[model samples]
Target: MDHDLALIVGLVLIILSIPSIIAAFSDGHAPRVAAFTIIAGGALLVWAISSKPGGYTISDVPDTFVRVVARYLP
Candidate 1:
C-alpha cells in the first residue's frame, strides 16, 4: 500500500511535469526544472515499484489509484 501510494504520486508528478517540459522546449527555454522533476519522479516511481518483493502489474494501478483517492479525499 505504501509503495502503491508513492508510485501513484510519482506518476502524477511525472504526468504533470510533461506540460512544463513541452512548454520549455517549445519556447526555446531551459527545461532544467521540468527535466529534473521528471527524472526525480521517475526515480521515485521506479524505487517504489521495485522496493516490494514483487513489483506491481498494470492491472493494479487503477485499484491503487481509487484506493488512494478514497483514502485521501474521504
Candidate 2:
C-alpha cells in the first residue's frame, strides 16, 4: 500500500480502538480485539511513517489524504 493509505488506515484503526478501550475500563471487562487493534495499529503506523520518504508527521496528513483521494477519484 502507499504510505498515505497505510497511514490513514492505521490512524483509523487506532481511533476505532479507543472506544473499545474505554468500554473495557468502564465495564470492567476487556476485549481481546482492543488489544490486537492497538498493537496492529501502532505497528502499521510506525511502518508507514518509516516507509515514507521524509517520515510522515501530523502536518502531512491533510495533504496525504487529498493526494490519495485524488488518485482514486474518477
Candidate 3:
C-alpha cells in the first residue's frame, strides 16, 4: 500500500478509536463494544504503518474516508 494511503488509514483508525474510548469511559453498557472498537482501530493503524510500501504517493482516493464511514456506520 502507498505510504500516503497508510498514513490516511492510520489517521482514520485513530479517529475512529476516539469515540470508542470516550464511550468506554462514559457508558457502562458500551465498554465491551468500545474496547473492541479501540482494539480493532489500533490494529488497523498498526497494519497501515507496517504494510506501507516504499516512497509515498499523494492521492485523493477514498480509502480512509470509506474506512471512517464504515467504522461509524457499522
Best by TM-score: 1
Task: Put down candidate 3 lDDT per residue, 26-56, tens digits, no spaces.
Answer: 7655567656765666665567655765422
| Model 2 misplaced regions, further than 4 Å | none
Which candidate wins on lDDT?
Answer: 1
- In order, candidate lDDTs are 0.88, 0.87, 0.60
My TM-score estimates for the predictions, one after another, are 0.90, 0.84, 0.44
Rank order by TM-score, top first? Answer: 1, 2, 3
- Residues 19-66 of candidate 1: C-alpha lDDT, one tens digit per residue: 998999999999999989989889878998889678989898899899
1 or 3: which has the higher lDDT?
A: 1
Residue-pair clashes per candidate: 0, 0, 0
- Candidate 2 residue lDDT tens string, 1-74: 87788888788899999999999989988668898998898988899999888897778898987888788888
RMSD in order of candidates = 1.4, 1.6, 6.7
